[model samples]
Target: MRQMRERLGTPRAAGVAGVLFALLMAAAIILVRLALPGGADGTEITVDAGQRGAVQTALELLPFAGISFLWFMGALREQAGAGEDRFVSTVFLGSGLVFVAMLFGCGAAAGTVLDDGQPPSAFGRHYAYTLLTTYGLRMAAVFVFTASTIGRRLGVWPRPLILLGYAVGLVLLVVGADMPWSELVFPGWALIVSLHILKGHRPTDHPSPTTP
Candidate 1:
């Protein structure tokens, strides 16, 4: 059992957590997007049975997603070892917590609308949307930026993956609220990073020696 526990405590465990988090979060986002109408005019919206069901399903999945995300964060920190920079690590951890909090907040707000069996008041709906698309995604952007930076510095990630992270972060930071389905970038990047980590290919740590 001890050996099993030790084995599960490796960076590969973090990669697994990252993969789970990515899938759960992507599902939640897709369900929510399908359930809710687009455009900022919340007052004009109405909720049907299908939409309610979708939102409920999304809310149910969110808590699990958040928990997995926390595990992923811890695993990532463990993988960073003692060489992690304090400032960037702080940003990474802080943004991840804030993102999860905002995600829960959005879920709670949507739950309230469901409980009432009607569309939320325009203010309420807009508030929830803003929390998710604006605050939550911005925090996610920060998390991605910091994670990518740490990965690059540690030589844990390929240059192409790091570049893709930058692009995803920019989208979340600048236009996440304006763009439909932009939140998908977060999970997409997470999936790629997790897969790479799982492959156990840290270039800096395992450089090929020159054949003299």
Candidate 2:
């Protein structure tokens, strides 16, 4: 465990994970608070079934951001160790973990909101929509970042799904102008993270790292 901790980083994987988790938790808390019954005038209120689904959908999308974070972290881990597979493996592993974490969080939030009734309200639905859209932007950033990272590392390139994701992100930004254009910042982020990933490890005389 100690050895694994050392590999995580100077501050360590646990610390990094904690920070990421905290951010997610904070988002969750905000969602939960909003989901609670409240009126437009700040009085207690209730919502309908459709409103409940809308609220749940928005809140659930957020944890997906964690997926990208985890992926980068995993990449960091491999890059941390000394071996042939090194940085590339680290990136893929980290990236995969990020996605997995996102899936879990999304699932949990959805389940909680649906199964457990916490009297719905106009305030909660509105708040959830705001946060959900915010999360969509973050998820956009993650997908763009990951697609670029993988492309740069392996030169294998992004599949159609990735390109589709980028397009969707852009559309969301334009349509949801009220929200920040964090997704629009993806190209820049992709360029930066790609440089860092490339900087760390050079290609061997052989081929690049495979996904499997």
Highest TM-score scorer: 1
Model 2 misplaced stretches (Cα beyond 4 Å):
1-119, 158-162, 176-212
Candidate 1 accuracy as TM-score: 0.88
RMSD values for the candidates in order, in angstroms, are 4.5, 12.0
- Model 2, span 56-97: residue lDDT tens: 754564454355355445544443343224454545455445
Worst 10 residues of 1 by lDDT: 203-212
Clashes of each: 0, 10
TM-score of each: 0.88, 0.34
lDDT of 1: 0.82
Ten-residue region with minimum lDDT total, candidate 2: 202-211
What's the true lDDT of residue 40 in model 1?
Answer: 44
